[model samples]
Target chain A: MNPILKRLGFRPDDRVVIIHADDLGMCQATIPAVAELFDAGLVSSAATMVPCAWFPAVAAYARATPSADIGVHATLTSEWDAYRWGPLSTRDPASGLLDDEGYFHRTTPAVQERARPDAVAAELHDQINRALAHGIDVTHLDSHMGSAFAPHFLPAYLAAAAHARVPPLVPRLSEERMRAVGMPEEMIAFARNIVPQLEAQGVVMVDHLIGMPLDRHEDRVETAKQLLGSLAPGLTYVIIHPAIDTPELRAIAGDWRARVADYQAFCSAELRAWVQDQGIHVIGWRPIRDVLRGA
Target chain B: MNPILKRLGFRPDDRVVIIHADDLGMCQATIPAVAELFDAGLVSSAATMVPCAWFPAVAAYARATPSADIGVHATLTSEWDAYRWGPLSTRDPASGLLDDEGYFHRTTPAVQERARPDAVAAELHDQINRALAHGIDVTHLDSHMGSAFAPHFLPAYLAAAAHARVPPLVPRLSEERMRAVGMPEEMIAFARNIVPQLEAQGVVMVDHLIGMPLDRHEDRVETAKQLLGSLAPGLTYVIIHPAIDTPELRAIAGDWRARVADYQAFCSAELRAWVQDQGIHVIGWRPIRDVLRGA
Candidate 1:
């Protein structure tokens, strides 16, 4: 059992989970879907992509809803074919954060191969600072596409979270699990060495990080149930990408169906009732943030 | 006599000029300068670049102050080396709006050579519609870098403005003046043919368009006075790009000094008195927009 769960007032045997939605400001389709989930109390946490075109809408929502548990979805890659964004801190090609086309590289491997660690750090800080300036009471930090989890970049990611005084989504995983997620051996070694030190410094670490495959378009509700049923004791972070079904979304995203399904699955009354019936404890990042801040 | 002055309730001899600022949403430096100029009743009109990162800030200002004479600066080029943006309508490589770097081409000639007329039209409409959706009472349409003035794209520009029922910036210039501004011979001929047709439809056209050389970082106040003094006895559009002096501005714009100078020049009490002493009548785009909308 992770001692940080105990610090968060959870028992060793308790199965606490945070239902977090990623990519809140990716486009028009995302904002309404996440807002609905937050309004219905279906989602406990969400992070905004600060570099995306629709970010100001998310900033407006955060200002309007001061209690919303929103954080910076620290971005290092612009993955879409048509929709793309570059780094906020620096546009110099020497920063190695941009692809040949000047947008952030589309893949994590490309980022790992090219992005300078100092530039990564600067961008992470810039993203978080921009969110703060927009009046977001940033609750935590997380990665988009796990770009920050690259071996060369992870230190900067942790440093940014530390600097922001917020928890980062650093889930505890075995070397095999890390390798299964396509994390390089160097990153696996780095995470193993550093995560424990972070925990020792009273940083809250999740015991598990569960998420549906982004490309899988099958029934998400059933998948959610299966994942929730398999949750072990300690804190778990359940990541989702939920967006409203719209023609604009269809144009912007290749996995539009999966995103729409995630929204429906999470917002469903059946799923809400099932989580309660299963005696699972659902928590948001706010309380954890408070604990970390020693409030 | 250009009949637009009469339709706009100005006499044929009225020295009416719109003291207009371009690139209001290009960066943070622009917003405050334009807002102050508008507040001080110095500058008469301004337009925003919808694709710029700071566009939402401009939208927020427009929403808060509904009477600001803001228009869409129809953008087809992202000229900055580090700071760049792409089209909103579509990001398909085939759209020809984007250069090899996936941003709008860095030069007007590149846009003229590669951009499809259909793509240019779609993007123009998208920029306008986006500003409208954000609560901007869009007052007029103008081109960025004169990209729309290309002979092939001029028709699309006119069509977009006609569809939106807003006046577009069509300045009546002689072949000599057009050639002096580096207008292609084809564009010069095209404008000569189309200006009369547009004027017949009651679209307000400026008798003269005056702007300082973008590369010239001289005493802008003296230049402004000279230009105002030389205004022909008809409606003139005096275009300026004003921005507050900031280190960020210094980074984003090569002509930061000139931009700051423009802001200072327009906001100066001396310049205001000089314009008044010369009997220059300052107006904004709102009245023209109202006339076009038949309000």
Candidate 2:
């Protein structure tokens, strides 16, 4: 029996998974696609980019639909070439959360190299606060582009989640696996120390995290099916970025085809039937939020 | 005697001017600059770009300061190279509100050639409605890059303002002057006929519209002083784009120096004293809104 499943009151053999969408408020295309997935009950959870231009639309949707399992996608990077957003806390040149162009750094490496820990902490809190202020009953917190997963920012991220009383999307990876994924030795050391502490404090950490290859653009439905078949027992988190095919999406994302494919794959009856046949016990962050809140 | 002055209970000879800031919510730079101007009572009114990424900050400011004279800057163009925004109503490629890159057309000419009239109307209404939804108590509407002032869009623009019961920033330009500024014959003909109708409906139009030369990067204070010295007795509208000097502003605007100069010019004690000496009666859009609302 997986201890997380036991904690969540699941049976010994239960295979719980969270089919989650990423970047729900990134653009107009994302909103409709996420809404469709939620309405169809295909995706169990999603997160929003608090700093994006289309975020107000997400806030409005959250206000109208209180049951949607939405979280704050703690954004620390603005990667698009023609569309950019900056830190909500401060735009000072010395803030260290900003690149030379005054937007968030475009890549995780740039963020890891340049972002000051205090600024990172402040920005993460601001993102969560802004989401809450906009009436989102935020269920969890997750990092965009994995920027907050860097060792220097991990403490701030955890503190922010603790402050907000929401479970963070933390995966229980071994130190070796973390290193294989390019996590620094500092992060591995910190994770080794903090994982158990968080688990002791009743934060739910997934047994595994899975995502599709970013370069795979074709046969996404087949890819998704294969991924589902390969899922192991215990709790797992699957992250998918799905967006409707629109000019705006194409303009902002070079991986528009892959995103569109994800949207189609998740929304298709074929995939839904496959998941049911696989007997995956789909769950959302609500239970984790409840646990964190001592409900 | 200026009929607008009589309507507003001002003497005919009073040199009423609106020292207005354009692009209030366009970025962080604009917000603080506009706030400082408003706090110091240098600028009389400012308009917000509802589609811009930083617009929620403006809404927050408006909510905190109920007396702030804020209006919707009906945005139909996203002109910057690295920072762009799209129409609020739709992101459909075929909607004709988007350019090849899926943003609002970068220039007024591009918008005029590409945007559908119905799409333009819907987007303008959506922008205003979005601002109102954000609790703006919107006082007026004006065109960004004058996209809404084009002949084909004029009817929709006026209709949006009428629907919202807020005055649209319409200037009383002579037919020859409009032609001189490259207004198409159709626009001149349309303005000639519609201006009278709008006035008869109690819509106030400024007698003269003045903006500093776009190319003037230096001596902005001197230029502003000279412009103030040349003000006519009839109601004149002075438009300024003021932004704090920051890396973000520099990245988004080619005329950042001029914008910063405008901020400095307006915030200067010298300029404030000069305006006082000139006895220019500064006004904002709130009174116009009241009149349009039959208050």
Candidate 3:
């Protein structure tokens, strides 16, 4: 175990990390923010969404730097009114997965109702192959919009992750573990039922995951402090989405105010100072991979 | 349950669909893919990685077309070697998460050893703010490199995710669950156990997840077939990183071979035909959101 794990109260590093960035090949602002976050000490790893057109640019960057920690942002859905892509598996009109244009239908339900596992897997493989073709040294995998997790799609999801040998960012918990971690009963029962099924398929899982702070501008500092004070000694993950607001964004976004607020919080200096004051050890995905592998 | 869910399940009229594009701001390839996908009816929703350098290009596109399903790609790590970025958090030497050039360390371990949760959370929020400030809609939130799931940083991850009220793509499971899913017993769990916590916090977790296909070129087809044959019942998410290779990419990527292979697989007509023959369905995120929210 690493020395830091012990200090955090783990027995010779009982903890793990999965420092991840969302939407790798998503948009212009995201590319730099994710790259910069990774470049700086704020994050440890990031992933790329294949279907998005910007993926090549991201892939080129990844190719240029082979050692960068990258993962496949497995994409099953194409989002954006004006911009979208079809499944790597071309659509069949009969499947209804695609619209009149033959591209993917604009939502998960459409895919769920019309998409087939065969199509999903094909597109999935195609996306990965595309990344490899572009020279990306992907280390892990994740979902683009959680479409794979919707009802009736779990089986294919596990098979794909196992086939890839790439560690999945999400974990499926069991009832006992959920209880130990203080989860609600319904969740525990739900976990108990699902855990065994997921394990049977060779899927990996995690103990706990956390989300990042989402406070308004006024509450940013206090929220950060409170969250820091509540830190526990266990492998946990927090998720956040930050972006620099632009007029173009406001027009497209249903709620741009919240997004702007999040960006401000990310750029805040006070939060950084507070983290130092609290001595909370921040980490990312590489350690988590190591810890998991070591275990 | 949302009305969309009923239609998706074949118990109602009108098949609901959500064709979401996985990546938008990732790179030049992704941008075109998304645009083409949308144009071709292949996808409907998309997001952006605000921190990425190529964001300007994506932002320009979003500005011109306000209907895209654009969201913030919350960034945390800079995994690439030559390409890296720093956290929005105030630069701190103690964090030790910085790279040689003072950007976030390229590897996850380096960031884990030194990053501060408070700082991490702050930076995450700041990135969101940046997205909003730019005119990005940021419909939802997700991780770039799984930065939010870092072992020591999970608490901060949760705090940030919860604060945002946006859904995060967490798929945690317990060790025992993996056993049920056929995963090796010795493997440490990371994502499963956190399901309850995420659910309790009202954070959205994908039901299932998958990864990109790796290793052999010919094996890609069989892998896709296997993936299709064994899909489980749920919203299964499969991740992939696809990009068009170029001289620029060759200069950057150490694993140029893999990138090339991935691209080949993605563009293969055989795979697309196989998917069509298999009757697989495809969808996107917006439809899923509608189903979940009953919108």
Candidate 4:
């Protein structure tokens, strides 16, 4: 059981949760949809990618809705081919973070290959400070494409969350503990080396997380119900990419249908009623952030 | 001799010239290089592609520079593969103006094949009006990739110039007249039917032109000097695309060096002295625009 949730006055066994949507500022079409979800309380929170084309709109929303639970999805990768973005931090000309066309490389591996930790730290700070400059009192700090999870970026990631005094998107279990809790040993072993120092930063890591094996969600609503039904003791986080299906979205991302499914499953009245009936406590990053701030 | 130039108060045999740099707002790097030419009184006029990525800077420049001669490069083609632009006018989902990928087609023939004249006109008005709305007092209008030279588009091209009460970038000679001035027979014959109607609009056109066989200019300065030396006794429109050579420009356009050469030749003191020594009166679209407005 997570001690952090108990420390925040939740029962040791309470299934505290945060349903977060990623990539709010990726495109114009996602704005209204996410805003509607935020208005209806269909989702717990969302993070914005500051380097995206539609970021100003999201930033304006953050200013307008000061209480909205928003974070900078600290971006260091530019994924799409025709539609691309570059790094916020100026890396060396030889930095592996940038691609041949002078855009950030698309994947975690590409970024990890040449991304200096100091450069990564600078970019993370840039993104966070940009949100702050735009009057966004960001609720928490998270990673984009899980780039922060890379071994090279782990210290910077933990340091950033500590620096910001906000809860990070790290899972509750340590790498060895994650293996004990059924996370693949291959994944956990790499993280095991950094676990002690990351824990030493006094960051609040989540107890359990269930959004992995994204391929398991062939029937997203069914999967959501099962995941909700099987929630373990203490806090768990579900990281989802929720977006309305539009022509532009389909053209932009190959896995866009999954995003639409996330929106549908999360926003559905059925899902809401199911969560309520199952006695699940719907929460957000705000309380977790407050606790981290106090810590 | 240019009767239009004479009507506009120029001498009958005056070799009036407009050193016009097209695509002023095509990129961020081109602005400074083009502005330097304008400040040096090397380029008499420049035109901006309002549909381009860097239009706002050029628009801001136009607002700040009331005396600067700038015009709209009405565009309907999305030429470059990686760096493409879309039409201002959002047509119906089935509008032929849009390619399968939901952008403007890549060439004039593609636009001509499926383009509705009304759609073309709407897009032209949108581009022109966007410049106006951005506070650009457009001095003239011209084709991009010579899309207006296509037979189907010529009417809308001429009508837009008249509608805007601005000079259209057509040579003073008709296709047949171009041949009489030593242009190719086929080129003149292709333009014969519409030439008279285009002329009847009372729109200002250049008496003769240079910048032909743009591929022929390996030594751009030599080309410019010879073209100025052999200028016929009438207005000559020297159409050139100028840019500063950078990695971005090189990646975007293969003929970047030629564009840089155009910038170099036009901005050189030698070319200014050459034009002055030969007594070619430097003019711009403003006087012609006034002539059209008065007519």
Poorest lDDT segment (10 consecutive residues) of candidate 4 chain A: A82-91
> How high a TM-score does candidate 2 get?
0.55
Q: Provide the TM-score for each candidate, comma-separated.
A: 0.57, 0.55, 0.44, 0.52
| lDDT, candidate 3, B1-295, per-residue tens | 3222344573322222232344455444456545544554423456676554446567777777766666566666666543444554444555554554445566655676677777777777766766666676555666665556665677666566446444455554546655775654333344445556556655554545654453444565566557654655444455544444543234334654554454455456676566556555555654444455563
* Per-residue lDDT of candidate 4, residues B189-238 (tens digit): 76675556666756555777667334544878888888778888778888
Query: What DockQ does every candidate get?
Result: 0.04, 0.04, 0.01, 0.03
Least accurate stretch of 10 residues (summed lDDT) in model 4 chain B?
Answer: B86-95
Question: What residue pairs clash in candidate 4, if any at all?
Answer: A172-A206, B172-B206, B175-B188
The residue-by-residue lDDT of candidate 2 on B1-295, one tens digit each, is 6566778888877888999999997866788899899988879999999878677678888988999999999999988754567776665566688876456788999998888999899889878987888788899999999999887898899999989988899999988789888888988888899888878877778898888766676988899989988988888889999988765566557889889999988999889888998899898999878865775
Which regions in candidate 1 have their CA more than 4 angstroms from the true location?
B1-170, B173-295
**Taking the true A–B contacts (Cα pairs closer than 8 Å), what share appears in each candidate?**
0.02, 0.05, 0.00, 0.00
TM-score winner: 1
Give the whole-model CA lDDT for all candidates, comma-separated. Answer: 0.84, 0.84, 0.56, 0.73
For candidate 4, lDDT tens digit of each residue in A101-197? Answer: 4456788777887788887887787677767776788888888877787767877876776677777788746555566656456557766655555
Clashing pairs in 1: none
Where is the poorest 10-residue window by lDDT in model 2 chain A? A86-95
Considering only N, C-alpha and C atoms within 3 Å, which residue pairs clash in candidate 2?
Answer: none
**How far off is residue A125 in model 1, in Å?**
1.1
Candidate 4 local Cα displacement, residue B25, angstroms:
1.1
Question: Residue A287 error for model 4, in Å?
Answer: 31
What is the i-RMS of every prediction? Answer: 14.4, 15.7, 16.7, 17.4
Which order, best to worst by TM-score? Answer: 1, 2, 4, 3
